[model samples]
Every structure is written in C-alpha cells, then in structure tokens.
Target: MKKSTLALAVALGAIAQHAGAAGFIEDSKASVSSRTLYFNNDQRDALSANQRSARGVDQRETATGLKFNYQSGFTQGVVGFGIDAQALVGFHLDGGRGHHPNSNSFVPSDTDGSAVSSWSSASANVKARFSKTEAHLGGALAPNLPILIASDGRLLPQTFEGGTITSKEIDNVTFNAGQLEHATGRASSNSTGLAVNGGSKESNQFRFGGADWKVTKDLTLQYYYANLEDYYKQHFLGLVHVYPISEGQSFKTDLRYFDSSSDGKNGQAGYGFNNNGGYAKNANEVDNKTWSAMFTYALGGSAFMVGHQRVNDDGGFVWMNQGSVVNGNGGSEGAGGSSFYLFTDSMINSFVRAGENTTFGQYSYDFAALGVPGLKTSIAYLHGDNIKASNGSGDQSEWERDMRIDYTVQQGVLKGFGTTLRHGAYRGSGTGIHDQDQTRLIFNYTYSFL
Candidate 1:
C-alpha cells in the first residue's frame, strides 16, 4: 500500500480505538450505497466535411459505483470535534477501445483509448462545532450553491478540496464562506487547481461568501460573491416566493441574476481567458451579465413550470473548469467538466452562448395520485436563439426535449431500490452546436448501519 494510504489507515484505527469514549460511538452512523448506470449518446449531423468523414459518436457504456460513509458524533466539550470519512469506487462493466471516445463522459479511457477497469478514492474531513456554527476542513466536498456546484452527472460526483464555515446563529438567516484550493473531476481520482472554461492556466485560490435570508414565511432572498483569482469575479442575487392558492395548490416564483468581470491575469496577454468559446467585446476579459426567472404552478400531484433566461452580448456565461488540468496519479480521461446554475443546463447542452435568449417549460406528475406509489415522470423542452457566432455568421438557434421517469420500491426487502430512465434530443443550426440524442438508465440502492 502507498505510504499515504497506510498513514490514513493508522489514523482511522486510532479513532476506532477511542470509539468507546463519550459521544464517539454512541452517536456514530455509517452507510453504504451503490449505483449502476447505463449511458448512451448518438451524435447526428456532422458539422464539416472532415466530421462527415470521421465516425460520429454512437457509443454506449455501463458502470457501477459504490460509496461508503462514516460520521462520528462530536466529542464531549464546549467546542465539539468530529470526523467524517467517505470512500468511492467505480467499476467499468462494458466499453472497449472502439466504444470509448475522447469525451470521457462516462468512464475514463486508458492510454490506448479503452475504458479503464476500475478506480477508487477516499477522503476525510475534520469538523468542529460551537453554538450554531460549524467549520470543516478537508477534501471531497460537494457544494450546492449558486456560485459553485459540484457536478454529479456521471458515475461519480465531482469533489473539491477546501475549508468551509456555515453559521445559523441568527434566526431567519444563514451565512456561508469557503476557500477552495482544488477540484477532482467526476471521472478521475486526481485533483487539480481551478480555471474558467477554455482556460489553461490554473488558479489555486477560489474564495466565496454568501448569505440566505428568510424575510417572510413565503419569501426568501439570497446574495453571494465569488472570486477565482486571476480568472473572474462574480456576484449573484436571488429571490424566491411562494403563494398558496388552496389545499394542495400553490404558485412559486424564482428570480436569479449574475454580474461578472475579469479579475487579474484574465485581461493580460499570455493568460488563458477568452470568454470560454464565446464572443467577448473586451477580448479575453470576462465581461458578462445573465438573468433568469422561473414560475411554477402546482395542483394536487401535477406541476407545471416555465422560465426564460438571457445571456448578455458581451460573452457566454462563465464558470470554473478543470478540463485542461494536467493529470497526476489519476488517468487523464474525464479530468474536467462542470455544471452551471441555469435552467438551460440540460442533458445535451447548456444554452449559454453569447447573446442568447432561452425559453423553457416543463410538466410533471406523481403517480401516487393515481393510486400508484413511488412512481413519477416529467417532460421538459427548451428553445434558444440569438446566439452570437464567433465566425461572423448570423445568429444561431437550438432546441432540446427531455423526458424522465423514476420509480422506487417503497416497502419489503427491496424497499430502497430505485430506478430512473432519462432521454434527451437536441438540434441546432448555424454554429458549433450539433444534433444529438442521449439516454441514461440508472439503478440505485442504499443500506444504513448505526
């Protein structure tokens, strides 16, 4: 075993030896979960003569993921201390050299361009708590905030190495702050520094602060500021409100806005900042504004939603990227990809190009209302236009349709077993976008121990 791994084991053993102490074993919890996923993607309509000559993507693969977690209660003291340990393993069940592509969306590929057999990783966090505030220091964190969200679209979820503090000492308000140093991609075990999309230079510092306030029983407001040193700085404002119409019926509204600009080296030459594949009025400087609004109505077991989003003409929506990082001990395949907080973030594409306007809608139903429990389905569609092309072409447009169905066993030995089916189709005209079809089938289950 590696020296690092051995040392980690020794530390964990020491903790286990003290499990009998107060608050150590009495409040401990452990759980294991597994997921099996089948992914397929078919790209249609070649963009050029070379693309026509080359093989279009028509690949399918299957993989399995296992996750184990252990959480220990805080020690007995005015300032309590605890630890959390998590481990992940992924196994590639199918996909050979011919089926594997450079995309590396599902499984990491070997040097010969074949899917890897297996990969695994482990992480731990040391935590402390006082009053209603808590601090954590560790790697393998999955943050779900508007400014930064970890991607979990693949076999494993993306993780970040960082320190974060969250406090709720005040009523109706919550505060959060964090400093992230590195990120591990969903398909690889190695971690790398951060950068914006299409940027090659890695920035090790990403600082953020945010707050969520509940102004009323039915309304909430949020504001956040984030900076990726030498990349970009961003600020976000959000609002959410709900109005009850009747029993089992309500209306909801959500509004979001973002303002961003270049930080340091982004505006300098020799630095990797080009507005991430979009038209930036100020050359490589990050200059963009984006806003979106969504409304939903619910009656009984049915819900309907519609939303619109606008991306400014200066540049495409910007966010962190790790795709260009140099792979260390982990495989190079599937090293970087990301998720943005947008309604247009769909299965096949994110309609975030420069000068884009997107309209989206969705409808969903719960089968429980129809006498069937643990079953639900939804369908959504999005259309985007006025995309600015870098080649001086006219505006481009694209559309996508997605459908999903999920079912879970509610009782018996397989009570926690769950399955989901998702499909999406996309078509575009005038620019880099392509026509594609994608599908995913997922099976999941979990067991808990105390």
Candidate 2:
C-alpha cells in the first residue's frame, strides 16, 4: 500500500474510536465518476528515420477510468479537522501494440511496448481549519495557479504531493503558500520529484507563495512567486477586470506576465538544464519573459475572445516537467508532461517558442439561447511567428485551429451524462516539431452517494 493510503487508514481508525464527532459523520460526502476517452493523433509531415522508429506516425487509443472520492466534514471543535480520500482506476478498452507507443500520453506501456490492461491508485489528505484559514497535507492535490496547473487532458488528472495553507482572513483578499515535493502523472500511480522540461535532474523542493486581492467588485489583482530548487525561479503578476456594458452583456480583460531566471546548477555542464528545448542567449541559462492579454465580450449565450502573447528572445517559457527521467521506479513509466496556465497550451502544441509572437481568437455559443439546453460549441485559432532557431537565425512560425462541441443530458436516467468532441489541426514551418492533427471523444458521468 502507498504511504498516503496507510496514513489515511490510521487516521480513520482513530476517528472511528472517537465516534462522537458529529460533524465528521453528519456532513460527509462521497461520489464516483466515470470517463470514457478516445484519442487519435495523425502526423501529417514526414519524419526522419530515428523519429519514425521511435514513435508511430499515426496513433490512436481508447480507455475508461473510474474515480471515487470521499470528503469528511471537519469535526466540531475550536480547530476543526477533516480527511479526504480518492481512488482512481483505469482500464484499457482498445489500443493494441500498434497503437501503444510507450509515450505515456493516455496509458502506461509495458516492456514490450503494449498498453497495460489496468491500473489503480489511491491517495488521501488531512486538513485543518481555523477560522477562515485552512491547511492541507497529503499526496492528492490539484492546484490551479498562474505558475502551475494540474493537467486533466488525458484519462486521469495529475496530482501533487505536498502541504498547502490557504488563508482568507482578510476581506476580499486571499493568501496561499505551499511546498510540493513530488507529483503523480495522469497516466501513472507513482510519484516523482520536480524538474523543468528536458532537464533530467529532479529537485524535491518546490516552494511557492501567492496572494489574490479583489480590489473592487469587478477588478482583481494577483501576484505569485515560485521556485523549483536548482531549476528555475519565477514571478507572476496578473490582473482581471470585468466591465458591465449593459444587462446580460459585459467586457472582460485578463492580463498576465511572467519573469523567470536560472536557479542553482542550471548552467553547469552535467546538471541537465538547457533552456528546456529553446535557444537561450546565455548558454544553458534560464532567462525568459512572457506576457499575454486576453479580452472577451459576452452577451447572453454568446462569447467572443481574442488574445496576443509574446515570448522574449532569450528562451522559451519554462515550467515543471518530469518526462525524461528514468529512475527505475514505477513513476518512470508514465510520469511526465504537465500543463501551464496559458490559453495557447492547446491539445497538441503550445505556442511558446523563444522570440515568438502569437495571436489567437475564439468564439463560443451556448445552445440554450436557441432553446437547446446543455449544448455548447466553440472554435479557436492561433498563429505564431518569429521563433528563434539554434543556428542563430530567428525565423520560424506555426498555426493551429481547433473546434469543440459538448452536450450534457438534462433529465431522465442519464441526466448527468456528458459527451464531448474535439478536433485540432496544426501546421508549422521552420519549427522543430512536426505538423499534425488530433481528435478526442469523451463520455462522462457522475454519481453522488452520501
């Protein structure tokens, strides 16, 4: 059994011995959710011999996942305490040896390059609440912040192992601080230390602190600082504002900026940090600046959004990645790849090359406006240019177009069932990656039992 599960078992035993905690038993909640996913990726461009041998030009996979969650209310006391537990199991539906490339995108591969039949994992956390502040410690954390985001793009969601404290004592202001030691990828059950993309060295310490201030009813400000020890340090600043144009219509503005620099041992020869696959002005040094702004206009069930982003000429935007490490541990098989808090982080690509400038726009509509409730569709396009190359020439560009539709049953036996379809096409010139097309189909449902 995993350490987290064992710890939770002991805590539950202790709670059961003292069965008089009214809140713990009276206000508990439990739920189970299931997701079925179909994924396909088609490589349109030709690849070199080595690339062709390493991965399939066209790949497809299908899988199903079940997730169970339980949340116990805090015990009635001056300082309330509680526990949360989650279990996830995945089963392979289709995807034979030909489809399983050992890429760890949707499922873990065996030694013979075939997808595993099934996998399961469990996690738990203990939490304490005092006034308006709460502290949590455990291995099942999905943090959504400007610097880090847990990916749910695949069959399962990524999770982190760590401790975090959130305080909302001040009116209209919230404070957050956390220390993360390891992460469990969406496809694997084991956990590993943190590292930047392309870096092999893992750092056990990831420290972060942040604050959000609601200056007014329509405006908010955010600032955060994060560091992956021996990898990189980052600072983030964000602003969001919503302006009311009239009834049922509004204009929203979101602006974000990030500044990153090299930490210890990044520029050294054997420490394995080399700007995470982009050209850096200083050899192996982590130096980057990224900024983006998005504006949206909403009226009833229709919304339109446009945004632009710029990556400084020094290096590509850097974030935690654990894909390249192979430590002989179970985590090495399916633990890698992460998501960043950016609109351009799409299904198959991220428009974050060094010296790149990107423009993007999207249009979405809810069918409820037309009397078709629980239906929605959206389309988006992004174009990027001025990517820096390794040979001192900074000429590269890429573009992607994406479309999605989703529907949820509003009534009857399958009232909570949901279906989603997504497709994307990407093309690039002078970029290191290839042009490709990707599609995903998903069905999901949830049941609650208390």
Candidate 3:
C-alpha cells in the first residue's frame, strides 16, 4: 500500500464516521513500546579472510521491536481534528549467515543472505487544529527538525512521508513547515525516494522552513531552511544558552551553523556525491560549511561536555541518504540510515569528512546523586583532524570512543524497565575507514493504554 498508506486509509474512514465525536473519545492516547537490541560489530581493519568474507566483517545481531501508538484528541473545537497511528514490528532473534549483512544495514535481508523473520509496518497521521496552528498529514513523519534528524539508530525509526506545520502563534515563537516525500527505513519494510549519501537519483522534493525563538528564560534562537529537489541547499543557524550557576549549578551553550549549496542535478550523472568518503570541492559537487560549539556543565547529578566541530574544506556533511536507493524488487529499499543535527553524530564515527576538525568530550553521571535511583553513566570522546585526502593525498586522522550505561526500574512491577549498555571504538588513519568496534545492548519497555 503506501500511497501514504492509502491516504491514511481514507483518513481513517472519515474518522471512523465520527464515532461519537466529542473530543474524540475524551482525548485519547495509547502506547506500547518494546525494543531489545544486541548488536555488535568488530571489523577492526578486516583485511583478509577474503576481506572478512566479503565484508560481512565480524558482525552479530539480535532484534526485537514492537511499537504501537495511537492518539486522537481534538474534535470538539472550532477546527480540531486528529488521528495518529503507528505500528511496527521487527523480530529476527539472531543473526548468523556469517552474521547477517546482505545490507539492510541491520536486518531485513533474505535472498540467501539470511535474517528477516518478521517485519511489519503501518502508519497514519491526519491532524489539524487552528488557533496555535498544527497540521500533519499521512505516513508517520518523525522530524526533530533543525533541517531534519529522524533516525532512531536502528530497529525502527526513520519515517517520513509528508506534510507538517506547526505554529504556536507568537509568545516565545516556534514555527516549522515541512514537505517530505518518502523515506521509511530503520530496517526496511520499504518506502524510499530521497537521496544523498552516494545518490543514485531520487529526491522527490524535500522542503523545509523553521524557527524557534525563545529569547529568554535562558535564551534560544534558531533558523533553518532546506531544499533537496535535485540534491542540496541547506541553511541553519542556532544558539542556545542557559547560565544559572546557582542552586544545582548550570552553564550551557550550544551553537551550530551550516550552509550548503548545489541543487539541481548536482554534479550530474545520477546526481553524484560520495563526499563522505571525503574531499569534494567540485567533483561530485555540493559545497558545504559546517560549524559547531557546545559546552555544558551541570552539577547535581554531574554532567560535563565540550565540543567543537568544523568540516569545510569544501564538502562532506549532507543528510537524507537513501543509501544508494535501489528498489523495484531489486531488493534494498532499506533506506540506508541517516541522522544529522550533528554534534559529530557518533557511535562509530561521523566526523563528517572533507577537511574535518573535531574535538569532543563528555562525562555524565546520575545515580540520583548517589542514592542510586534509576542509574546512568556516560563517557565519550572524539578526535578528528584535518581529513581531506582523496588522491591529493595529504591529511587524515580519526578517533572515537564512547561508552554508556543506564538502568531503570524505579518502582513496582518492573516500573519502567529499561537497560542499556553501549560501547564504541574506532580509529582511522588515512580514512578509507575500516577500523571499528561497536556494541549495544538495550532493552526498553513501555505500556500505557489510555
């Protein structure tokens, strides 16, 4: 199906024929969530063993996911109406066929390459409101805007299929606009058209607009613009502040910037760009400029962070990648993972190439200030340097380190049951990129039926 799920099933059959429409069943909501991952990757420079058996390179997997959501409130007012729905399922309890890897990146592969025992999908969204404005339409769009970031790392969450609007009429300002065309891949149940990382031509128009101005109560400001009709055009700016330093301590600041160019038929030939493999001034076009800054300090449950980023010797740093879009039954509409609203987006590296320069730091802790309630921990590190190198052969360097821990189950029958453990390590030298190590273990739960 997917014509945005047949126009959200004819707008949920006209909102289920207005089933007693008074505030839509008194403001409904429902939820279900579950996740379980256990993924591992090693590939530390897998040089041989036939290049680690043709690149499946030391992997491991496990999956479990379930998600359900429903929301329907609005429906009693002047112009209110609503519906939101989502459903997902993934289950592939283990890997092995030399650890999966027919490239749906994390799962969904079976044509003689294994993995893919279960998969499911569903989506809907139709909404409206007026007064402070709201609008949404079809296919579970998940946008955490600043020019787009919707990739929940794996096992589901990378959705989009069109239409959005938000307003918040004045008072502290917030506005957004959108028009996404297609994407659905956090492990494929197929939906694709949008491209960038090594574009194989797709781009069914993506447009955006943005705002966020909360000029006080600890300042904020942001701006955005985006376009992808034939391959790139982005702009963004941001700033945030919080400096209270007294009662529990605080000091935070963030800044970001981006500017990109090259749109129509970018660098031609199927709209090329492989800049992520570094250096690209005019070769596969799309110029870029990036910037970042971050600082944080909190004291109550301890937190500290630091950052710096820059990548602009000419290219690299672009988002929305359908990972070489291939579909029409030729397999893989796996939409190749993406996320960008960068703080160097890392876990196994994404110091966005072309003349890179990154530096990062982090430390976190919260054990309920040592009374240990729900626990937490963190560690991070990144170090990128100069990078460029693409035959002009010169600079390159990379580094990564990450760690995490979390726990939850705060009160009764497994209160909120959560657990996580993560790890990462990466290293590189000339940037053909291959040293790696990664791990994840997660479990989560949620249930609410209201």
Candidate 4:
C-alpha cells in the first residue's frame, strides 16, 4: 500500500473509537449536490485528410453528476480528529458516435470510441486539528491555490490523492502546504500520476506551499511555490486591493506573476515540454515568466473588469496538464482536462504562447437591482497577439469572445436550484489552432442534511 493510504488507514482506526464523541456527531454535516451539463463544441476551421482522421469535426454531449458529501466535525479533545467523505457518480444522458470525441476531456470514452453508460468513485479524508491548524490526508483533495486549481468545467470535478495542511494561527494570515501523488480526472474513475501536456511519463511527487496575508481589510498579498519532481518548479506572487469610492462603488486591483524553470529530468525523452505549441528558447525545457494585472470597478449592480497579461519571450506559460498522459492500458486515462489560474485561461483557449501579449475585458450585471433576485449576466472578450512560434515561424494572433447567463430559484422548494448558460467563440491566425465555438448549459442543486 502507498504511504498515504496506510496513513489514512491508521488514522481512521484511531478515530473510529471517537466516532460517536460529542462534537463528532453533533457537528456533522451532509449534503448532496447534483449537476447536469450539456456541452457542445463546433470546429469551424477546415482540416486536411490527416487532420480530419485524427481530430474529429466537433463534440456534443450531455451528462449528469451526483456528489454526496459527509463531513464529520472534530472529536472533543486536545487533539481533535474528523473525516470528510464524498461519493460521485456520473451518467451519460446523450451523445452519439460522430458527435462525441474519443478523447475523454468531457466524458469517459469506451474502447469503441463511445461514451460510457455510467461511472462512479468515492473517497474519504482523515483529518486532525491542533491549535489553529488542520491537516487532511486522502484521495479526494481539491485544491484551489496559486499553483493548482482543481478542474470542474465538465460533468465532474478532478480530484487528487495527497495530504494537505492549512493553518490560520496568525491573525489575518493563512498558510497552506501539500504533497500530491496522484489525480483522478473529471471523467475518470482511476487515479494516475501527474504530468504536463505532451509528457508521457508521470511524476509521482508534486509539492506545494503557500501563504496568504491580509495586510488590511481591503489589501492582500500572496506567495506560493510548487515543484513537480523531474518536471518543473514554479513560484507565484500576487497582490489584491480594493478601494471604496462611495456607498455602492469600489475599485479593485489584482496583480499576479509567475516564474517557472525546468526541474530534474525535464526536457528528457518522456519529460519534455511542448511549450503549448509555441516557441521555447531551449527546446523541450521549462523556462518562462508571466505577469498579469486586472482592474475592476463596481457601482451598484454593475461591474466592469479589464486585464492585460504578458508572456516572456523565453517560453510559453506552463501548468499541470495530463492531456497526453497515457494509462497502463496504453490509452488515454480520460484525464485530458485541466485548469490554471490566469485571466487568459478562457473557455476555448489559453493565450499563453511565448512573447504573447493579451488584453481582456468583461462587463457584468446583476438583475437583483431590477427586482429580479436571482438573475445575472456577463460578457467578456480577449485578444492576444505577437505569439512566437517554433522553428522560427512567424508570430501568431488570436481572439475570443464569451457570454454567460445565470439564474437561480429564490423561493419555494427550488430555492437553490441554479441554471447557467455559457457560450464562447474563438478565432486564431497563424497559430495552427482550429477556430471553434463552444456552448455549455448546466443545472445545479444541492440539498443539505445535518
């Protein structure tokens, strides 16, 4: 057994004795969340015979997901213990052969290149608390940090197998640390080692640490560091501030920066980086610096946001991506989807090519101000240019536009029911990327039981 699995077993055995303790039973909480999603992607660009054979024309599918969660509070003692468990199941509602891609970015695919009927997974985390710090060890970790963002764009959310510690011992400050060994993809039931896009070999170790400091009520600073053994190392710094202009108006500024470099074995045969199909000063090596700044102004129910991001000329930005990681069966492990923390991580494409400069803006409105309690809408656009290509190819440019609408029931039995509709269109020139339009419709509801 893995060390983490063994540790979890021992911890669970120790905590079993106190499962019925006062605080444990009294503070327990349970909930079930349901999500149904309809996804459609239309490729608009023309393709050659080889391209048509390898890449499908488009993708359209629908799936329903149910997640059940149970969180038990810490037992009463100097050192308290608890457990968080979750079960997830996904069912394919619709999608035929020609409309569904064999790649499992959205839905699990069978051997015959068809969607699976259903899939399920379950996990539990053993936790302990001391002072103001808490630690968890399990296979169901979903981390939202500067170095990693658990992906949830599809029917189910990606999960990790690892241990994490969080502490708030210092006032106005938070600390986080973790080590992940494996990950379960959003559409996969099995867990696999970590790797970036184009990397076939997997790395078993991914360590990260970070701190967030609230300097003031409206000001915050963050720093984080991460390392994927034999892959890459990265550091991130961020700052956020909000300035109040009036009773119902404020201005917010957010800044982010990242520095990444190759680690042990990086650029090796199976550990090479593709640079997202962009230029790299040193072929197959990780070397990049990126920075972005965003400003937002809010007045009443209206808000506007704008941002600019730049990627250094050395290489394209990099993040954890298992898109090309092959499984034991010599097939994709259904782990192609991933998420990164960047304004350029749009619905269809991420504009992080080397030497790229991107400008983005968004406008949003809430209908509550107009007496519609649970309605909201937003639209955004992003344009990127001066993207350097490999082999001394000419630079490229791209643009994307996205729109979203969300509504929720505010009363009666469906008070928490939510509906979200989103659409995005992307066009690129000289980038070798296909132009596409995408749409997603989602319904969500959650029920709580204490």
Output the number of the TM-score-best candidate. 4
For every model in order, what is the number of clashing pairs? 0, 0, 0, 0
List, residue by residue over 220-257, the lDDT tens digit for candidate 2: 99999999888889999999999999998999999999
Cα TM-score per model: 0.92, 0.94, 0.34, 0.96
Against the correct fold, how does model 4 do in TM-score? 0.96
Top candidate (lDDT): 4
Candidate 1 lDDT, tens digit per residue, 1-450? 644345445655655655566996788899998999998876766445345324324667899999898888977667777778888889999866445555564677666556779987788876778989988777667788889889988788888877889999999999999998788788876777888876878888899999999999999999999999998999999999999999999999999999998898886754556654667787777889999999999998999999999999988888886746433334356767778888788888888878989999999999998888999999999998888877534378889999999999999999989999999999988756568888999999989998
Off by over 4 Å in 4: 46-56, 326-331
By lDDT, rank the candidates, best first: 4, 2, 3, 1
Which residue pairs collide, candidate 4?
none
lDDT (C-alpha) at residue 111 in model 3: 62
Per-residue lDDT over 93-125 for candidate 4, one digit per residue giving the tens place of the 0 to 100 score: 888776767765677777767777898889989
Once superposed on the true structure, which residue ranges of model 2 sit more than 4 Å away at CA? Answer: 1-19, 47-55, 274-276, 327-332
lDDT to native, each model? 0.82, 0.84, 0.83, 0.89
Say what the RMSD of model 3 is.
23.4
What are the per-residue Cα lDDT tens digits for candidate 3 across 6-107?
Answer: 876787787777747798878889998998899988776766656664556677888988889888887766787788889888888876777665666567
